[model samples]
Target chain A: MPPEPDNIPDAGQAEEIAELVAKTPDTLPLKRPATPVFVPATLPDEPVEAPENGAALENPPVERPISVPQAESVPSQAVSVVAPVAPEPVSPPAVEFSPPPHQTFRASLTLELRCATPDASIRYALGAADVGEDGTLYDPAAKILLTQSTGIAARAWVNGESGPLALAHFEISQPQWEKKEPLDQSDATPHEISDQRALEGPWKLAAASVRGKLHAHRGGWREDAFAHDLAPAADGTYAIVVVSDGAGSAPLSRVGSNLLCRETLAHLRDALTQSAPLSTDAQELRERDLPLLRVVLVEAARHALQKLNEEAAKRARPLSDFASTLLILVRREWNGQQLCAALQAGDGAIALWNDDNTLTLLGMADHGENSGETRFITTVGMEAELPSRVRFSIRPNLHAVAAMTDGVADDYFPEATRLNQLFGAVLPLVENGDAPGAALLRWIQYEKKGSSDDRALTLCWRDDAAPQPETVTEETSDGHA
Target chain B: MTSQLISWKVRDLMTFPFLSQLGITFALSAAAMSDIPPPETAATEVAAPENSSSDGGAPELDASMRRLPVYLVLDCSGSMTGEPIEAVRQGMKTLLSELKSDPQALETVWMSVITFDSGANQVMPLTELLMVKEPSFEARGTTALGAALRLLLDQINQEVRKTTSTQKGDWKPLIFLMTDGEPTDQWEDAADAVKAARVGNFIACAAGSQANEATLKRMTDVVVRLNDLQPDALKQFFKWVSASVATTSMNIAKSDAPVGLPALPPEIVIVP
Candidate 1:
């Protein structure tokens, strides 16, 4: 076949010439004549052809020779045959496409024209070569569809001078998906997190969890969990909302997060039953309920920690293998006041979008010294700090309360301020939807660079106009709880 | 914010029809594999949708837009002349191309090229994969591996942002060092400093038969040796490096251990 790009030197000819030059000295009378003594060695063209396909290769490990297993009977002869000049490299590609052409997608390609020049306008023509500033003014929203193999050349037009012409060729082929399997089959978690919604009185509960794009790409587990139940409170029904983020490095963190959410709510329900009911009056409850609410929250958190340890012990896995972060809240509505008690460990946030129209981070977000570092529920002394971690609040005109794993929490990072942005976006999903759980799942997957982690969010709010409620909601109650 | 969220959702739901006419066609890339994929059709979600941005630039380029800084510290010594140097160039071309195609890497990966010859210099600054001007390479003088390490250290410290109360930091940096021979300069203390600082997730590559493995071990726990010095090995090596970048960028709030990278291609072997 003809070389498509004439500029590329023919590698086959180069290698042959290199072999001839290196062998000239070996053929002389002074050199050791050992290579012809061992008859079965094929030297000229085998190593060149051995790695015919990438699939045929697997790493034999470091500090070791290539496991090609050259004939050992006459090892020195093997070296002397082609020993002088080692295997040379194949020639470089004719033209180095700036970012090499990597993929051939089955479906059409979605192309985004980018100009790093801060305020440059990008213009492009689909079928042309180098469409400087003459194609069409680029719109960020109007998607550019490439349904066939096309050359897209775009340039940033700024200050009457064009930036380096950005050119790329996209190839379209039949649908192909690269699949990555979980390393351990027995430790596999669910592929998709199901939507769960519940309603009581004017109060509504919507909980959702979705595997992040990266995790989905890698066949990684949806390590986040969201669960809510209208467990019996002291005087009224309390909406117990919980969300946990499992450690990505942990082998069984998906199981751990799910277990922690269920146990914590269960333990909290039983613990709260024997407590004194504080006055439903908003002013009185704030003064009286603080001490009692803190204790019950810690007790529930401690029990959940113990459950993780027990589950870890049962599976014969390290405690760290079942590590996860926890965010749990128990809130009740009585008279006109809405009182909430939140317990958090690790980095996720428990925030209340209060009636006063301000976002309040109910508990502290604990990130250790590093960027990706955070304390897990299974961390030593986690329970010791549980009491101080609880935050109790009484909001008379409460709008909504949300509990989210760091997957969702970190997207709206520096959660102190950006949560209002998250809350503003989520309010529409809750108020104007029949399946808020499903909406929440889809809504949390908003495109953000470098923010790919399994997102789990639970939102509960009171809708005074939704003409009360019957007890006819699908109760996600397991008989054990 | 709501509009941004809705646009992404809308794109996810959109489907396309294949065009009958191929426009502006070119010959298959030299790196392109010849084998056709088996027609195994499964409703698998696109593994890399997260990499592409339907929107032009990341909004405000704020905290959530955490950068995955990738440093390529390469040895362009006299020994790396001719075929070896060209292979490095070819490998980088393929690596950068593959990274840009990946949406996540395109969106978040910022790469810097550092080369060492008689002395080390930052050939390219930390720039976004989408906007980076990949520099042309040449093989000139002795291997100054120590100067390369020290320069890499300084660049990382100066470039990588740290997470504070007000601003989010860049993800832990990934450093890939490719060398074809032993260092001619004093490199021991520099290598020790790289290990001691606990700066980046380092993966050193011994590029050819002349490449020294013991010298690389002092700089990093993860070291891989390039086999044969063939173009195929070089291609596979760059492919694995790109995937390693993707793997590190994918990991959010992970453990203390080195991030789990994809398995090495046959042309490379990990030093245990």
Candidate 2:
């Protein structure tokens, strides 16, 4: 007589197979092709209710167990059925069953699990699997097949750390099984990736400026100013950039700032013409010609001040009404080396980007007795000491240099720390083919915490410079006057 | 006789509150709010929003909104018993009313009121201008200017967040100190402490002929003298204070550099 179909131990057989699959190590050979299991279509469509004893069964089923070798050789679609009889004295009388070979019902299921975080790793009873970079995980025939009444437990490690264990109960009435939605859906995207190639290359100069929100809100004019003149040498070896900011207190500071930019560029042009012969030797330029550069910086300020005074006089306004600040950067090619000199007055800052992607703040803002207060180029004592304020240095692998007014300075150097991290987000885009000035203008305008000042920024870089190894060097300077 | 005289002056000033109100109304109407383009909207032209983030990796726009902390340090001493005290109350009401009407001031200015007599008390903690209520004043004891300064210093340390390595802090505070007599307590030490803190701009106003101008000058470089305590003169002084505060609030929002204050009213002379 054939065994009764109701006595088939489907749950007990599945539990044993699940235990065997859980014990298999990840290093086990994959030579055993994935097996697709088939079970009777009459299995319960919902999770089986726990037995009355509340304890899980541990005894083997009445049917014999399949050996590991035999199990590996089983066809993917083959199904094994075992019936375990309860050893009770009052067992119900078994009903005779007639087996119909041609009418046997069978079904197969394929399960796929996905993690919400793309980087998540999932571990199941049948072993562990990692989600692809695209955040998907699929098992052709989950080594231990799951029937309609089977329960699955999985633990996920998001970003390499384990999270809470997840328990899911399966219910399927068809041959193929799938959940309504993905198991996990991540909301976060990967860190921003830029198409570096799209950015224009071999940039020589970038500049941008914007009116502050406060200024806009109050209907005040943009008093801050910035200007840059990048004059690449005929030999493609040197350049000169000049930037300036007008005083916020001065009624005609915008004009003053514009004049300063023009005058400084003219002065620099004259100095470059005068020192054309000394540019050939790097040592001579650094040692003997450094004084000349300093004098040039002072003369530039004086000329700018004289022009501003003329304008103020024309308007019958006090020269103080046109007060402003100035910054000048000169890069000279000497014997295959780059020498840089910087001059600044009033409130603003300068930064140098090295080949290694590190930024060095050259000079801090010239703050006055208070935080918002600062000395102006046209102030009573500043013109006299302009030359001494010039800072000089010899940078071997300099990639770029940036200058900004107090509006930008307040955001970048709100405190004493020199190189704010916010600027790091900007450095990569300087060389990007996009208009560096326009990019910088947007960056400077980013709403800052306490500052709402007219912002101005100018950047100069060499695209041909080779990238340097990562070596962070902090160069401190007495930024306060 | 002195007490009788004080009572009469107080009654005279209280009878006409419209005068101060009219002055503030005229000042606010004459001034215009600025109309410059905002920086953030302009920034989008260069870099896409997705590519930009603050120093932190989080994709958040930098916020430009900030609070301008203002402190009104008043002298509620015996010298200000009558008309002077009454004028102060009217001045405060007018100031608060005008500021509340100004959208810019309402958005940025945070105010606190500190009154000093035998002791100093913070009648109002730092609060938004729109939310502030005019404080009641009663003049009775000696002027304890030193104690007032000490109290101010403590309040500043507790109230203001100085800029830190990783965080932005409140703007430098604007302090207005109005007094009518010499300090009855030791105030130099407190003044020194205030100077050392260097956290805000302190403008001292010496009211009446008997006010100690020299002491006021020592406390702050920006000092003004009120020639008399007449209601009109006091009203003019308050008008100037309101204009100064309005201009300062507008200036910081518009410019990065420190701006010189608006000219003081003719009746209130700057102490050179």
* Candidate 1 off by > 4 Å: A1-201, A279-289, A333-336, A368-370, A466-481, B1-60, B100-104, B184-189, B208-214, B224-236, B250-253, B261-272
DockQ of candidate 2 relative to the true structure: 0.03
lDDT of 2 at A449: 36
True contacts kept of each: 0.22, 0.05
lDDT of 1 by residue, A175-248 (tens): 22233566767656665564655555687877777787777667677788867777665566777887888888
Candidate 1 lDDT score at position A157: 48
- Across B1-272, the per-residue lDDT of candidate 1 in tens digits comes to 01111111121123201111112111111112222122121113231122333232322457545778899998888877766676776677568656765665765688999999999999878866654544567889999999999999999999888877656678788999998888999999999999999887899999888888999999998899997676567778888998899777767455645678899887899888
Off by over 4 Å in 2: A1-201, A232-237, A277-282, A310-316, A332-337, A414-422, A428-437, A464-481, B1-69, B77-94, B100-110, B124-146, B153-173, B179-240, B251-272
Can you give the lDDT of residue A331 in candidate 1?
Answer: 84
- CA lDDT, every model vs. true structure: 0.65, 0.56
Backbone clash total, candidate 1: 7
